[model samples]
Target: MSATDDVDRSSWLSGYSDTVEALPIELQRNFTLIRQLDDSAQELMDDVASKSLCLMNQKTVLSPKERQQRLANIGSLLNEVLKRGEEKFALAKSTYDTVDRHCTKLDMDLQKYEDEQLIGPTMGRPSTGTSTAGSDKRPEKEEHKRKKRKQTRGRKKGIAPEVDEGQQQGEYLSAEDAKQHAQSAISLSNLPIDPNEPLYCYCQQVSFGEMVACDNDECEIEWFHLECVGLRTPPKGKWYCKNCAELLKIKQKK
Candidate 1:
């Protein structure tokens, strides 16, 4: 190899060694011990083979009893080596399993901490204004105005306002009435499913039940099962998924 190539290789090796050394002490020690054990095991096997060969080449003629004793000794030595190797493998596997469990627990705890921070009690606190009470009530008023504005816009566009089916269901209606109600409601054509997409819902893999399509024109998630969104029946009129609803809210604010 060229001198420059050798220098580059040396530098890479040095960096890799530093990275390994920066690992947790316990992990580094475990790796070091495993490497040493592997090397020792290899040397031992080599030594056993060499010694056995040397013994076989010896000119000393052995009786049947002596030959059997020699074979037994070699077998015992090999068995000991195998036992030691097995023990080392078991130890390494156990250490890895313990580390994996600890990592999983740490990840879960970190996620919980993040969630708590995001949804803290003070997150939506109103800023100071002329009066504390007025400021506190301002958010509720703004929310009401936003809903009214959305309804007004829907009416202007000749679209039926959204309604929660779960809340609006009245006393028993006949099947014929129900069918008529469904027909009168805005009809959303089924969006074509992608050829590569799975036919079943990712959340629950069963027959595709009553489905709803997002009203948003630009949403990539064309359709999802009503059950997947915790709805027994499709909502009346225009429907938007939670994500699309949030987006529309932001757009309105802007």
Candidate 2:
């Protein structure tokens, strides 16, 4: 087997070896000697059994002196094996007691570490203190501000703020300029004007009808007949042509 295979095989016994090493020097030596004695005793027993088997297979009857000598050798080997077995048992018991003690100590240390580092701080609740003067007044100030906002919200809609007049006049002037430009462009075209049709009326392309002008002053197209745009009656409020409505939406977005 490779060195890696040897290491892997020994890993299961690593804990046992570590426990033994932690023992006192005298106990360590005693355990080692016990293991050596056990191995030696096993070898001697195996040798004696093998020799007896060979003798029986050969059908060779032993002389009386040889028989006695063989008996003596077997008896000595048996006594040695028994002695070594007892010593090994004693050493094993001692080693087990030492390992169990070490394991117990380790468990207690782990529990102590967990209490001091993980549980102690979390279990002790922090003390509460009085709020500062500034903090104590903050809520009252916020309540007053909220009351002022509610009072403003209760005002009548008729008292709303007025729009700037200069902005309105500028819009009116721009609308008039756009209308003049559209008229000039139409005049430059060579197409003959139909006197029967209203200018800027989409309904003229489809059918003749009484047309209404868009309320938006900036719109170049002036009139629309409701029938052509799928409306049964004139719309409520200020009405706008499709082109002027699109332009108004763009301005509002800006």
Candidate 1, residues 32-63: lDDT per residue as tens digits?
87777777778778877986996789699989
Model 2 stretches with alpha carbons more than 4 Å out: 1-31, 54-69, 122-254
lDDT of 1: 0.59
Judged by lDDT against the true structure, how good is candidate 2? 0.55
Worst 10 residues of 2 by lDDT: 164-173
Q: Compared to the true structure, candidate 1 yields what TM-score?
A: 0.37
For all predicted structures, in order, the TM-scores are 0.37, 0.32
Model 1 spans > 4 angstroms off: 1-23, 121-254
Per-residue CA lDDT of model 2 for 1-254, tens digit only, reads 35875686488358646754756775677778787978988897897798677656756788989878877877787788788788887777666566556666556655665445443443445533422343455467667765564344323211122233321111122455546644544553433333333344552442233334455655665555444444444443355667887898899999
lDDT of 1 at 135: 38
The true-versus-predicted C-alpha distance at residue 253 of model 2, in Å, is 61
